[model samples]
Target: MLRSRDDKKTQRQKSEVWPMAKAHVYQRDHINTDEIIPARYLNTDKEAELAKHCMEDLDAGFVKKAKAGDVIVAGDDFGCGSSREHAVWAIRGAKVQTVIARSFARIFYRNAINCGFYLIESADAVDKIKDGDEIEIDYDAGVIKDETSKTKIQFMPLPDFALEIIRDGGLLDHIMKTSA
Candidate 1:
């Protein structure tokens, strides 16, 4: 749900608000996992170091200030590269909770879920959403609201099963819970 600017102001004025510290806007399609976290970093077994280089080209300073629960808004084909699970691992390792994009590479999408990363797709949502926009995503409602723009964007809702898996931390955890 993308909210209008006025709506965002209203929301902020009402109470405590968390604003995005950084925003990365990409113009191209098919930004693969390599771009998100370069292959060279893969040599290191530690995710902490690997995530430090994530999206180095896109945002060199991201690793320094990015917290565990930051949100990433990207354009079409956001994760279109290799089938490396390390890519997903690095993102999760960085502690990013959600990724909103126009479209995603099939493998990347599934890999993200398997690693407990929430991925949402919204065609024009990325365009309308700017960097640092105080936004709220309602996973159950399939909406992304931009408090700054006061714009609301609708996205495809995650299937209940998928949500369940994510809610449980990942497929492995989900399986363990059900098996028990």
Candidate 2:
């Protein structure tokens, strides 16, 4: 189980398995969602097109090489810029199941969960993860393990309500399911 300290640490416990596609290392600060998905692609309102241009600034060919179920490990203050839900959409569209970062922008973190995008915070956890490393995220156990390195890290788990939202595929889906 991965254990971490973040604002949402008082949540529930669960575990999930997420495969890695491409890992982006953030060596800088103030990297916002715009840099992750860019505002230019927002015009189309299509996640596929938006995903095609994801992380263009940081990694030019990232979207092209990404596969489904990929998880991203990033540095501090990730998704820090504008509260564009499209950023979360693009990542989800690109098949990125989860994102683990040292820290997340408040709005971005909320938006991600609302969109069923799993976002985790762990500064030290991100340091131990490398590109192409297979990671097992045990939400209930609050543990993260790097299969390749045989290393384990800890992070705080999400709340029960948040976990339910994600399990049902975002807020919209959850609402629709319950409303029926």
Candidate 3:
């Protein structure tokens, strides 16, 4: 099948690398899914609607402060609690490019990747990165650079399969591409 020029251009746009993102520091641990997106907002799975309330209970100013390419900096045990996919969806819908944490709840980690959301686990980086710091992440290079502090933190690179899934925009899209 041949794609039109516009279709190819659209595909190219989708594959473009993300730019450096700003960080919003939430230096607390054990931030549960419910806190990320309250149960009251759980009535809908619509990302746009859910995004309006993401982190409202925990940080009332989050929605107002968030920008399309902002990153979330959090402490250990981020996204703990119920296995709700809405938690990740809301964050993505808010246009947050990625999340950096000392650690993440196992289920949340997996769910995040499944939704094509980026998450990095590095205890050292989380502590050093201040609120509203500018940061750049190079997944291929496995480096997280804090522009504000002029420091670099290294994290274990994602496995090849995981990277492939992420690059292709989530597990479902990756699977569909391979299947066809």
Please give each candidate's TM-score.
0.78, 0.79, 0.86
Top candidate (TM-score): 3
Q: Give the lDDT of residue 100 in candidate 2.
A: 85
* Backbone clash count, each prediction separately: 19, 17, 0
TM-score of 3: 0.86
Clashes of 2: 17
- How well is each residue in 100-158 modelled by candidate 3, as lDDT tens digits? 89899999999977666667888888878899888878766778788888998888766
How does residue 77 of candidate 3 score in lDDT?
Answer: 94
**Model 1 alpha-carbon miss at residue 91, Å:** 2.2
Candidate 1 residue-wise lDDT, 58-86, digit = tens = 67787676774567778788888888876
List runs of model 3 lying over 4 Å from the truth. 1-20
- Please give the ranking of all candidate structures by TM-score, highest first, separated by commas: 3, 2, 1
Point out the higher-scoring one by TM-score: 1 or 2. Answer: 2
**Residue-level lDDT tens digits of model 2 in 1-180:** 222222121122123455433455555566788788877777776766777887777778778767766677887788888888877767766767578888888888999887666678888778888877777777667777778788889888788898788777778778998899
